[model samples]
Target: MNKEARLSRLTRMALGRESSDYLSRDVDELTMVEELKNKYGLENVYRFDVGKNIDGFSPLIQDVLETPELLGLITGSLTEYPENSYQRLRRQLSLHHDIPPEWFVFGAGLESVIDHIARAVLDPGDHVLIPVPNFDVFQSVSFRMGASLTFMEMPGLCWDGNILESLCRKMKEKTYRLVWLSNPVNPTGQFIPQDDIHRLLSHASETRTLVVVDEAYGEYTDRPHAVRSASSLLKSYPNLMVLRTFSKVHCLPSARVGYMAASSERLRQATNTYRPMFPFSWFSLYMAQLAVLDGDYVNEIRRRNQERKKCFFNRIRQQDSGLETFMFLESDTNTLMFRHRDLGADALHGLLAERGFLTANLNRLTGIQNQGFLRMTLHGDAVNEKFLDACRWCGRHLFR
Candidate 1:
């Protein structure tokens, strides 16, 4: 048998579809930082690319690392399995959301959850509807599952309510097995209003399509008294499933803990069947359980995230006339995507790299036109100020 012939058709197809431009490959954010540090020296390089670089783990979470019990788990758990299958974490999350614990399906991360969703819902030649300028994972996972894709493009990275309404109306006309959505969308951080999502959900329900809303950044958008997560609509829309991760606002990307909630028992059973066994480490599960319990800390992260973003945006708008080359796109979350009016995203990315700053190059990450946009996750005050200075220096040179 020939070497290429031995590979599955789906594997070959997925390989052909992989983009070298995407940063989520083997060269991840930290690896990029380390490589840059090697080239530019340690003290000079700044990481503006990854959202996981946000403020420290909550003090409540920090306290757990100091515990003797958690340390003992490191050496003790080689043979023993997790006894409760993460029931404690699920219970905490259920109580937090006022949902049934059994509705939750745990995965190693949102990436894993997404893969499970594709496995559970997609079949060969099945149709999947995705709104582009969103996470690439949805497209990759679905395609790998032998699903054909239809994309609704949001050119400005923010969905116009009217346009989304139109799409919702047309969605019922098509037979899609899966509908992928990202609330507080990745790269751009723009959110679809609940009403718009509800409309989509209604249409999807009629079509019997499984609508998966990825709420990885839901913490940044959900308020104290108000609800923003589509998880809130699970009861109202049985066709809906909401994906959440500990990676974003909880600052637990290292934990590899993510889960999805669906009110439909059938969907829940399918997802649960597809989920990876022992998806979380003992420590990771404990950390997530603690993180969920500390609601006040999560609230603080949300508030401070907004404050930092607002300050950064204000500074950009108020920059001197000569330094007006860059434009900040409005975003609803801590991660923001912006662009240079004069320079292309690749050019700006190279320029920033030369200046010892790393940012996400958002050139071909979308379907309805690439805007030469670059994205950055908001950092602390000192780091943001330094990044602003780098921008000012670049702006002055361009505008002068």
Candidate 2:
């Protein structure tokens, strides 16, 4: 086949493929809830199924509803209040992270931002490096843009500096345009050190490649400074783009608010080329603004989350002798990744779902081979206890 024909075939394959249904659950909604109620008890049944912070609920909703000034700022028209509000937000975020306001582009969400970045920077067949066991959104967007994804398997339970050097070598081998990674990576919850991040960026800069860092869970980390904030890195590396979201940290996933910090030139190019779709709803923008400004609520959620994660770690250590357990990669995040040799995670996940517990199936996540590892999001004391009991029960019944 000719080159054009091969390109056409690849595009067809991409466009024809369905969006991933990993988020889909087939259990009866009512039955699932009832089972949750039964296992964890009606009052204590906590859903750690997603990355949302339960503590941010009341303050987030309350702030959005009570503040009308926050509601009126839509994309098209900018009155003084709305303009000032946006400027204020930009100023605060820029000051907090020590980046220029011009370096950031506010978008509908991180997924939208990724799509925009892909559109701006990638051509068909261009190579994009990504660590495996990632959020599917990265691969999905890259494929849609006709970019070839090069997978770099993360060193299990730790960040290996060698991986970054190897990735640099891979970049040198091709006209690879981008490197995408998640700090405190999803599923594994491993934190990449600042030095390693610097080496990656240095390599990318030398090769004229853009490094896209997704700090979606940076706020949850105990040592936030160890991982270079994308905003801060932008000053030195113009080729670096930092992606952040209100979804995980602020519990505003429904609000669909996210932003990218990069060099001013790159930010302008992305905004111009992609033309971000505006105003998911006046309500979404309002909620996002409220969430960002509500420092007390953010602090409270962080505090409770830290406490919950500590409690979970303690419980897991105590129970790990009999059951398979995954530990956080020496980071201050609430997610844990572990492997079980005897019971395949798919079978175990199914069994847990039947018993009213839901967790991320690690095997299906990255399509990487694993011995039944699963990722669990820690919610709070009650939820942590339930997960512990569920795992203990599963270990005894399923593994035995």
Clashing pairs in 1: none
Scored by lDDT, the top model is 1
User: Candidate 1 has what TM-score?
Assistant: 0.93
lDDT of each: 0.80, 0.69
Top candidate (TM-score)? 1
Cα shift from native, residue 92, model 2 (Å): 2.5
Give lDDT tens digits, candidate 1, residues 84-103.
Answer: 46778778888778788888
For candidate 1, the per-residue lDDT at 308 reads: 90
Candidate 2 RMSD to the real structure: 4.9
Q: Residue 38 CA error for candidate 2 (Å)?
A: 11
Clashing pairs in 2: 326-338
